[model samples]
Target: MTPPVPSVPPASQPVFPLPCGMVLRPWREADAGVLVAAYEDPGIRHWNRPEPETPDSAVARIRRWHGRWSEGGAAMWALGRPGPDPAVGLVGLGDIDRRGGSAEFLYWLLPEGRGHGAMEQAVRAVSHWAFTDAGLHRLRICHSVANPASCAVATRAGFLLEGTMRGALLHADGFHDEHLHARLATDGPVLAEPAPGS
Candidate 1:
C-alpha cells in the first residue's frame, strides 16, 4: 500500500495597522482612484517609477501584489483608513534577499494625507510587521537627495542615514544623488510611547 501524502497548510496573510487609525490591507479593485490621486503628487512621481495609473493598470498592479503575497517574503499593501472610502496609499517591502534576510521599503500617500504623521506611522507599522512576521533582519529605504520630505520620513521612522550614492539615479530632469537609509530588526520599534502626563 502506498503512503498517503499530507496537504500543506495555506500561507498566512499579514496585515499591519498604524496608530493613526489606518489599516494596511490587501489592495482592492476600488483602490484605483485613490492610488491614482496619490501617485499624481509631483514628489511621489519624482522619486519612484512612473505609474500608468489607469483603472486597468491599477487592477493589474493589485493582481501582482496578490501574487507576490502568495509567494511569501515579498509583499505590497494598500494603506487604507477605517471608513467607507479606504485605500489612501501604497506601502511595501520589496527586493527581498532571503539569504541575507533583508528587503527594501517603499511607500506613498495621497496629497491630502500628507503633513500629518500618517506616513511616519505607517512606515513604522509596516517595518515592525515585516521584521516580526517576515523574519527580516534589515530593511533599506533609498531616496533621491532632492526629495527632502522622503528623507525626513525615513529618519522619523527610525532609519539611519548610512550614506549617499553619488548619481545613483537619473531623474526626469537630471542625475541625482541617492540617500540610503536602513533599519535593523534589533533596533526595536521606532515610535516611542508618549511620556507620562505630557
Candidate 2:
C-alpha cells in the first residue's frame, strides 16, 4: 500500500525582535508604499536590482510572500520599529529546500534603516530562528562583493565567508562577483566583539 502523506505540525509564524529595537513581523498591506520606496532608492536598486514596483504590485508581492510561506518555499518579514511607523527593511529566507535542510537569506533596508546596526541585529535574529526553530541544517547569504555594507552584516551575523563566485549575479551596473557566506546549524552563538583591553 502507498504511504500516507507525511503529517506536519501546525504552528504560527514567529516575529523576531531585534536587539536594535526593531521587530521583524509578517508583511502587511499597509507596508506596500515602503516596499515601493525601497526599490526606488538608488542604493538599494543598484545593489538588489529589484523589479519596478507600484502600490498595487507591492501588495501583490506581499501576498505572494504569504502564499510562499504556506507552500513551504519561503518565510519573509518586515523590519520596523514597534510603533505605527512603516517598515524600514525586509529580511527573510528564500529558496528553501526542506528535504535538503537549507535556505538562502534575502534582505534589504531603506534609507531610514541605514547608519545603525539594525540589519546585523535582524540577521542574527533570523539566523537563530532558522537554525533552532526551523530546524535547518544550513543557511546562506550571498551579496555582491562591491557592497561592503552587506558583507559587514553577513560577517557580524556569524556567516563565514565561503568564497567568491565569479560573476554570480547581475546588478544594475553589470555582472558582479558575489561573496558566499554560510552558517551551519552546528556553529555556536554569533561571534562577539573582543573586550576593549583584549
The best candidate by lDDT is 2
* Local distance difference test, each candidate: 0.75, 0.83
Q: For candidate 2, write residues 23-45 as lDDT tens digits.
A: 99889999999988988899888
- 12-116 in candidate 1: lDDT tens per residue? 556666766777777777887766766677767777865749777877877787777776646777777766576877788887775567889888877766655
lDDT of 2 at 50: 83
RMSD of 2: 3.9
Find the 10 residues in a row with the least total lDDT in model 1: 1-10
Q: Which residue ranges in model 1 land beyond 4 Å of their true spot?
A: 1-12, 194-198
lDDT of 2: 0.83
TM-score of each: 0.86, 0.90
Query: Cα RMSDs of all predictions?
Result: 6.0, 3.9
User: Per-residue lDDT for 38 in model 2?
Assistant: 86
